[model samples]
Target: MTSHNRRKVRLITALAVGTSLLGLAACSSGLTAAPSDSSAMSSPKAGGNLRVGIVGGSAKDSLDAHSPVTHPDQARVIQLYDTLVSYDNDHKVQMALADKVTPSADATTWTVHLRAGLKFSDGKPITAEDVLFTFKRITDPASPMATATSLATLKRDEMTAPDAQTAVFTFSAPFATFPDIAAQYAAGIVPTGYDPKKPVSSGPFVLESFSPGQQSVFVKNPNYWRAGQPYLDKVTIIDFPDDTARVNALLGGQVDAIDQLPLGQVNVVKANPAIKVLESSTGSWLPFTMRVDQEPFNDPKVRQAFRLIVDRKQMVDQVLGGHGTVGNDMYAPLDACYPNNVPQRNQDIAKAKSLLAEAGKSNLSVDLVTSSAAAGLVESAQVFAEQAKAAGVTVNVKKVDPGEFYGDQYLKRTFSQDFWFTRDYLPQTSNSGFANSPYNETHWDDKAWSDLVAKAQATTDEAARCDLIKAAQEIEFDRGGYIIWGFPNSVDAHSASVNGLTPDKSGIPLTSYGFRNAWLAQ
Candidate 1:
């Protein structure tokens, strides 16, 4: 057995034994304790409106909770609606609207039990019927939402709400990790007749006013389920598309917090004792996507040559400003199933040249499309262009506007860049790994790889699922079109007076922009 397999065996054994101890602790406490983070130090005091500065927003932003396309949209959605489940600081799944979610023995069916007395901001009781409605709209064939990809296996016709508080979902195939999917940021629950124009929230806050690309204002939800939560009277999220203005907003005391702090400004911000910077290690990445079906990259040797030509270490150090770890041409470094045992791929100029020559492209030139949409994309592309010169390759870096980059030519580009937040292996793959993936920028499509992913998703046993996932990862490591060079840290900042902002591995800054727990210290 490999070291990865051995680790899985030990983990399963430990989980089996730990269940008894967990039961004992629950019995003693009369409830299962929620996971806690030690990063939050002081007690919270309430009653101040918090203003947060977020990066990147355009007029294309929408109030639709299910299809948030910008950082500001995502931040607003989290406040206006609650997902069934969410990731805590450590990236473990935790209950939100649903108190408990139980899977059937075969992992094909799931039952969700909502917390008693839950109500929408408008005072209507939150019910399973609403949950069913929300999901139905999300998976509607004619107009599916962003989360439809994650729920592709869901058997929409078999869904049922047998009681006001209980919802049942049946899938076309076994889905052992439904909770993780439920925790997606875009999977916010809504009412039966929900309207984006006039929203009813089940979350800690209710939308008061919004302006696309400008700002959004929210008021505390009086009917919020969590006790004494959403301590603030209001929240205001302002969009500062420019990094300099965003950082300045915090320094000037115009905003209480800011998300996606520029790596170049980390030292400058840290030097200010009045400000507190929270840094969390994340699985987030910005990869150079090479279309497998296109010229130059269509040949396996050419793909291999490009992969070897990248100086992963140099990119991580210079492009990320030493705020990240090197990537080995694979994603989901934080996932348990990630094949860490695979030998790390590094720059080999001689080998890259040889491979290029073998592919009859001894002197190759390619256009690398990139944009300033995300924080390090353009710089990474430029750095990579410089590094490719060592392997007899002339890389032409083409910078496009953020809006134009993700516009009509998004997935159609033969070579481009894309950004992703930290997600587990299966969910991440569902978005970008398959033939029909909505964001499959690389255009990678292989039956063998897809079959392995399907088997892994269907496997109820954790160890067996991980084994299948490792095998799939190995295939991608060998021939995948992504040149994943690094995983950057999520750096966010807030005023010293702000409490409850802690490090979160979700890669969304400020604990997935969870201002519900944040309060102004007196």
Candidate 2:
């Protein structure tokens, strides 16, 4: 094996153990280790259209970034819209649409400068007014953007575009991680008068034709600000909700690449000499949430009991096929700002039963709702159910359709399974699934946790922010309702002829994988 591949395997092995040991030897664990950059693997040739297949998409998909979450929606949105900032393959934040991001002296205000001479695909001049509109739309109560809660601190009136190039954002409280929040996919910039029915975007590629579940086509934007980028003349994305069909399409050269490759099929993809497997660890995690506001789970003892019974190492090894690292009930596994001081929670059936007995529910029979909608949830749920039996807990697994899983079944179920994408910032992770946030699956709201997040958000000192986050994570480790057992490594398979596709551990296919930056070797 090459020295880089050997080093990567060693790091993954170390991460499996290091996460269980409270981040020991994990500072640089999987963060620095990455797959070989395909861009560097071959000379760039930009002409042919690339055909990409993806799992987890349906006919109901739309261009609306907030509603109808699907793989195709995610893959297609980046082609049409651009976030202010996005993480590179190495998980480092880089400018996309915004030229400069700066903070005020008190950290309560932020200023953003737009790149000059930028234009939407429709030839409309891109300006700071568009940035303000994007933010205001998400924060608007009637909007479907899930990121509204993240911007709750900043009032719409506090945002201003003094001129076409400059925009200012004033927050009710200090927000040191504003740039990270701006990097979210949901924060994609749209025109000041954006109409979902008729989309206007400023990304590398412009939407040519969209046919929901069947296919979508994008042509290179001639007016794109980044000169000579989007090497392909055209890009085509097909919806392949069926895993087998997606793999078959890639093997048959029906498509140039595929995303969201299931772990069970990794061997099958690798067996094809014409195909190459690219893997990277990103913000991807599969976790089960127990609603703290509901019965049986309302009792802290029951929550603790559940945490004590599941074996994280077994989940990583068996379900993920050792393609992932252990999780500590918290997200942002790759972000350097994540707290590492919390004591790692391990499985103990005896202690779990004792806690259940103390909670007066010695014979607990609960239902676990998981769906095939997200990869590995059903398998992980089955494994977790088997492991929980040792603690005298009877778990019933209910699997549902992947289509309805995200929108209908996931957060609605009391004890449910779901998958989370990578978020580079700690605050973005926290806001999406913690405290009183709308998507808080577990319904866990604690003053101490919320206070720490607020303080950490406001604190500019890196040391102080880390300390506060560590303390908050400790509280969640002891009492949070999330069972974050494993962080799955993302695997994308593509034809050998395809080049410049950067595999990212952050798991964001569009920005992190450098899809726009990728070129087809003609």
Candidate 3:
């Protein structure tokens, strides 16, 4: 057996200490009747359909994991497919369908071995062909997925499968984050010739039915590779684009849980004695991007002036309700490579006015477009416009429907509100949001900054890599398109009876790391 298999064998062996293969029981209902004993409550019993609601759902939701744009679409991808690798609750890499991921000495080559006897939901063996196909599809230029840009370093020609169980990747240069890239939802593994709309999942659950802008249902996968898992028999994901409606669903017990709990309604949930509130720090941020290619914002001093006038603390306190940390322009907090030493940018209207004067724009009227796509986003924009008045600028606020924000308003406007979900890898976050990335909404392209990011990616030494990343972040902090004001903690609410739900800041709450591990209390 290979080293990866050996490690998995050891883990399975450790688990064998308590229960035999047949000792694990199965259930067929949404909730099974637990024994009268209180001890039964502490242990997970198989059974129950979990009904979950999420914010920001629309008819445009994509079943294709590689191209999902909204929060609900992202959450559904996690339920319907498994990545080559995945992260644990603490954001550490953990083996999933992939039994092992070994990198070469220079980090240019990576070898992936799938677990033995792995099978898709349709009972076909999951092999190297599937893994390679996933990479090729994600990197395809025509693909609308953000991952196409995120995995740009990967070359299709260098990807090969030596055997049915083994997949190999050879990069032109050292790319230490290949594993991180592989683990992302966009790179989720699917069977060869798999169809996104009617996907056959190898994950803990199988998609039963889907209704656009309505709800999607998933039933447990009995043949799932992970034994004795997915205690819940089914998961019903309901769409609620409106915050009040979503929260009301949870409060009325119509749904067991809700994702993206609005900060304004957090107190309302808290008041309910039967609701369990869970919060976790996330790298998620709400930022206003200024298109440097635009007229007034084309001037660097004006951009700097705009950044200086915003009160980040006030936004964090009033908008986030103190459930978040102040952001310093660049994204990726809670990750190891985040540049913590960069001096915090505080509100300075006098300095901003001086910068505006230097830019020959001492008097300016700017239109700030915003949406309610994320909580506090529109409010933050309004507060920022008020704050900029002290810098001798008139800021106009234009509101659009949250649904149309990402599709129409964002990137199309010279200045607009955008929110990014937390990505575990700092380099991935930087590549997706900054460093000449296609998603770099600000259109701030700097060769020197890109060079620094390249160096950081190629560096093998942790300390050296961190230094390079820090330098790149410092450049963005000084003059990037994003004015990151707050890193909000991901907050979710579930019924008091819902068990095993953990806070996840890696993006979508409750489901990003697989909600199959959760069960409804009996």
Q: What is the TM-score of each candidate against the true structure?
A: 0.92, 0.89, 0.89
Candidate 3: regions farther than 4 A off = 1-41, 424-426, 429-438
What's the distance in Å from true for residue 21, model 2? 30
Summing lDDT over every window of 10 consecutive residues in candidate 1, give the lowest-scoring window: 1-10
Give me the overall lDDT of model 1: 0.78
Candidate 2 local lDDT, 1-522, one digit each (tens): 000000000010012111212121123321222222345555577788999986766566777744436667767766777767655566656666876666666667777888789898899999998889888887787642656666667868779999998889999987666666676665678898798667787777878898987898888888887766778898899988777788889888899998877899899889888888888877677778899999899999999899889899999999989988988887766656566666788898999999999999998999998776556888899999999889899999987665666654445578997666765444443444455465667888888878887777666666777777667767777888888898888888889887777667566553343367777766
| Cα lDDT computed for each candidate against the true fold | 0.78, 0.71, 0.72
The Cα error of candidate 2 at residue 188, in Å, is 1.0
lDDT of 2 at 122: 90
Clashes of each: 0, 4, 3
Which candidate number would show the highest lDDT if scored against the true structure?
Answer: 1
How does residue 213 of candidate 1 score in lDDT? Answer: 79
- Give stretches of model 1 more than 4 Å off: 1-39, 511-513
TM-score of 1: 0.92
Candidate 1 per-residue lDDT, tens place, 307-373, comes to 8988888998898889889999888787877888899998999999999999999989899898766
Residue 79 displacement (Å), model 2: 1.4
Instruction: Please give the distance, in angstroms, between residue 195's alpha carbon in candidate 1 and its true position after superposition.
Output: 1.2
